[model samples]
Target: MKMSNLAVDICGVKLKNPIIAASGTFGFGEAFTSYMDISRIGAITVTGITLEPRLGNPPPRIAETPSGILNSVGLQNPGINYFLDAELPELRKYDTAIIVNINGNTIDEYCSLARILDSHPIDLIELNISCPNVKEGGLAFGAHPDTVYEVTKAVKANTKKPLIVKLTPNTSDIRETAKAAVEAGCDGLSLINTLLGMAIDIKKRRPILANITGGLSGPAIKPIALRMVWEVAQVVDVPIVGMGGIMDGTDAVEFLLAGATGIGVGTANLVDPTACVDILDELKDYMIENKIEDIRDLIGALRI
Candidate 1:
């Protein structure tokens, strides 16, 4: 299917394609530049940056499961300052849009980052509210509608750049949370930020990951991610960046049909460093075979 259109405008930022490298999987967008042309990607969501540098969790941070993996990296990063100073410059050379994923132990830290990044040249700021909220008794801000609204509102008050609130699937009703973010003034939403999961080593009689619990991601959670995306899409008016375990073009198409304006490629990168570009090709092929002239036609095209 010789196509001419693949560009998508996500929350005011233009992207060449609909596939974005999910945060945490792609580290600052520098590591994958060696394997593929980073410019070919739609956008790159950098690793989760914190207020200060962190070493992350101890060894055995990753554990392979049936069709997915458990990761307890604990948001280890070089801090936002280093990222703005060191990483941003290098990534800016790429043609794709730059979206930074940020986390904080407190609402103050989140607002601080937002205020600072608002003055930068970045395209968007994705709030990683999946992290534990120390002030709220260790619950993730994204899990509760009130916290989600408050945090989203506070961050939005400080930033002029487009804000994309990344939601957790651990909530009882993801739709309510999505609505809260939209009400709080988020420009877009990214759903299914790794389901809570764990694995055990029988012989050792202990948990496989040192953190005891971790985020499960890969093809195993694609179905759940799709459902959440569909649910949120039905309730909210903001764009949804759906992600979970998208590995191929067919998987990417499924997300678009589920009402995702943009697709996030996560574990696929670990499986194949060139997965982003490869999936873009597959998406084009799928569109061609399906007689789809424009990729945007696939968004929310699912029939009941």
Candidate 2:
């Protein structure tokens, strides 16, 4: 099948395929250059950027689990100036769409970052309201629908680029948050960031991660991610980028069937450097085998 068969659109941005390199995993699209052709990705959501640089959490920040990993990396990244001065220029040369994920400790900080990025050459702005590992701004603004609306509306007012709000799975009802974000003016939404969880070291009699608690990711959260995406899709007409434990083509297909316009490959990248391209190939094979031509045909095509 041709590559065009896998093309997808998120908001107004056109992706060559539905495979998006999720934030925190793809590392600004440059670190993976030696692993695979970064241009093959549909879009790249760079690491979470903040108004100021963050030292992140202490060591022992990542712990392996049965089918997943718990992480408390704490949104470690250079400040926005460094990203704009050092990273954005190099990323502009790539063929894929560029989605910058921005986070802040307050609504003003979020607006400031969006305002600064408005003049630059980016395809989209992903308002990272759902980072569970952080202490201040991320999950705090995401957990409540009212706060989600306030922050999303504030950020949307400050930028011209399409805003895609990434939602947290820790919320009581993700659909409420999704509705609030859309009502607040977000152009699109990304669901099921990471589930709140932790693990304990029996031998040491202590928590595995230094933070004691962390965000759970990988295959363990796929089912929950799909359910949230499906539930949110039923309530909103905007595009949805579904992520969490998307390790293979079959997993990507599941998200699409559940109503994700874009598929986010997170932990799979850590498991395989070429996972994005590998999954893209596998998805194409599945399409051809099923006699499906256009990739859009699979979006929201789940059979009840």
Question: lDDT: which candidate is best?
Answer: 2
Best by TM-score: 2
Task: Report the lDDT tens digits of candidate 2 across residue range 174-284.
Answer: 999999999999999998798999899899999999989999999998999999999999999999999999999999999999999999999999999999999999998
Candidates in order, TM-scores: namely: 0.97, 0.98
Off by over 4 Å in 1: 132-139
- TM-score: model 1 vs. ground truth: 0.97
In order, candidate lDDTs are 0.89, 0.94
lDDT of 2 at 147: 100
Q: Candidate 2: lDDT over CA atoms?
A: 0.94
Candidate 1 lDDT (Cα, whole model)?
0.89
